[model samples]
Target: MPKPAIFWDPAGLELDSLGSNSYLRSTDGDTPYVSLSIRMLSVDTPETHYPGRSKPARSDEKLAELASWIQEGAAPIDDGLAAHLQPKLETGRAGTLHGEQGEAAHEHFERLVEEKLTKPSGRKRRVYLKSGNEPFDRYGRLLAYMAPNYTRAERDEMTPLESASFNLLMVASGWAASFIIFPSLPKHSDLCLFQEEGRKAVEDGLGAWSDPLTLTGYEFRMCVKLHTVTKELMQGKKLSKAERLRWIDRYCCDMSTRGVYSPQDYYRVPAYDRIFIWKKDVNEAVARLNLSPEV
Candidate 1:
């Protein structure tokens, strides 16, 4: 059962009410509650933190530039973004735009919260959560999609678009891009709706999409991973392919080409077409989503 808890951020990443008022669980003694970290499903906002406060992306500086790393034999994330970020690095602005756009995305999401999840009385509205098949992400954040909790009357009065999940609303609002992953994939109809909203968001250049050079939150994480990997390689650490892939998450399906692509190819796949999958799940996803294997 869901509990009333304070959301710490617009992305629904974590909750601040760590004790009595918390998400997911209550201890047998009832004095404390387990803190739940949630990685919201179906959408990803821009890269928000540098010198980050958490793990996975524990900041080692946003190594958005690919030239030196590429010169060191590291693969380029994507040609255009590589060039786009290169100057920023050369001119000492490498991580600035990433952080700026992240703030922009967060502020945009707050506006979305007010518009989509606020009540007429100015209280925060209720929401329903739909989780993915796998409940916990690698970072231990619970994965979910928060939908507006509406009465039948309210549902009847609103259009499907208006009655969207907060996940969808984020995409529609233009701050978040469509971020579907395998096995956790929504129903086909919902996926189509996500694509439509994403199309509009991109076309309108809303939020992160407005900044042509902005990396999707996922891509930012990947670049950081690559940098980390390159760092280890630079130190001559002996790492297996699997061990190397463990932290650098970029595996996915390319919808346009109907093929699976590894993390390095992630930037080539557009947000709407990219279906992120953990490295281990790529085989299962191929069978489940019916896409071709990596070429």
Candidate 2:
């Protein structure tokens, strides 16, 4: 009973037998530009070469076989019959055998990039104003939210337009985070409100957070963390009072400022109950305001 033969898709490479000096062609019509053989350099012994088989070999199996052969110090001969075959031999020894697997993974990664690029916007635009300068207001909010500790000089260094854009992006990230963290909270509607507010903030010449790339990156992490928290919450596992307070504080800070802090910061600032208070205010505001458009 011979083992079932497995095959790999050889994109464009060939392997020869141990003794016969014959050219082997890959099933995909790819002919290697070289021939390989096993030889005893001490004596003028006849070289053995394996002609390429009609079908591809399984990648795993091919790797195993290649590993065994390399251990035997096989010499490769280029089809061009060049002076040396060191490059090809080195390539084989380095395990460059699975072209098909590489191709498949590349395709999958490309699809993911395409999906991200094609995401659609689902909210109405709204503008907010502050200090007779919409851009400034938006930027102020963004800086306050994102890099609160930044000095006035830092804020002044940014152009009004840039600040507004940054703030809008920060708002977008917050809305995106909410969707992932609380899927049941009418995400579409919240997004609409967020967009409207962001636009208003921008139009009023208020500084708005700009920088979709940064916001997207932050949202990516937030979504992952939110999923973990949501699953734990749904499990009916009671969080300790301290744990619940910590989560509340963290969520508040993230929502209000789009800022994240380490666990050490959370413990150090137990005195700053403003986060807890602000969280309650925001929750109440969301509840009172019919922000979600009826689906």
Candidate 3:
């Protein structure tokens, strides 16, 4: 029997509409940059009130109810339920230490608290240095290895016609960025047609940003703007396939211009890095679905 089709959506991330957040607007003009926010949704939290019920139902039951509520558009969780569950969620068994590892973890936790307390009121503070020793590195490595493999599998799982259509979308998205960065490339003219095909794919996906005509216009201007900025870099007669790919990587991943400047003037902030990294992951996931083989 054929395996079930999988649909993926990255949770807890939101794409803010233009003008919703004042800080996200471009400094010189009204153009908007995407602002991503992460939200915590606790599954252990209950939603209803049933006075004197047997221990307020099991944890698994509450989780199931939460899923149902979300599917039904997330009805407001009452204070009574939140009050009962919050303590349970917060309370966890203390770690049993056998060696220096326990002491180190405790020390790190205390240092984090001290740093948080030292920050000035109304001022932005840095958190989580980019050192590879952080707790999340193991998970990151696993994901990095798995994603490309998953993409390859996903691609092979599709029918021949589906593979052709999906690959066309990937090429189109690539070309959209390409036209902006290196219009002098041999296949530059093909971008316009590829872009139209991309629009159709976006519409079919029913994505939040799916507006074919508007996206096409935006992409055209984006290509022109990118060309203007990187013209000098692309000066030598023609850029190779690898060089063009590098330019696309830089163009889509460039958050330098969107540097944070607020209560603190820190140019490179931890939050900025985290958000950008998460955005890159989501973008790659989208690309994998389009171009990689299924798992």
Best by TM-score: 1
Query: What is residue 221's positional error in candidate 2, in angstroms?
Result: 10
Off by over 4 Å in 3: 1-212, 216-226, 229-240, 250-291
If scored against the real structure, what TM-score would every candidate get?
A: 0.76, 0.18, 0.16
Q: Write the per-residue lDDT of candidate 2 for residues 156-251, one digit (tens) a residue.
A: 986433333222233333221111121112233433444455445333433212222111222222222333343454466666655433422323
The residue ranges of model 2 lying beyond 4 angstroms of the native Cα positions read: 1-164, 169-240, 243-245, 249-279, 291-295
Task: Please say which candidate is ahead in lDDT: 2 or 3.
Answer: 2
Q: lDDT scores for all predictions?
A: 0.69, 0.29, 0.28
Best by lDDT: 1
Cα displacement (angstroms), candidate 1, residue 229, comes to 2.3
Candidate 1, 1-295: lDDT as tens digits: 9886876656442333343344665567765555555688988877766436543233424463344775454642456555544543433344566667777778877777677777777877777888889776766566898887888998999988889888888888788878888778877777878888888888888877776656667656656666777677767888887666655564778766778876666656667777788777877877876888665
Ranking by lDDT: 1, 2, 3
Minimal lDDT window, size 10, model 3: 38-47
Q: lDDT (0-100) at residue 112 of candidate 1?
A: 75
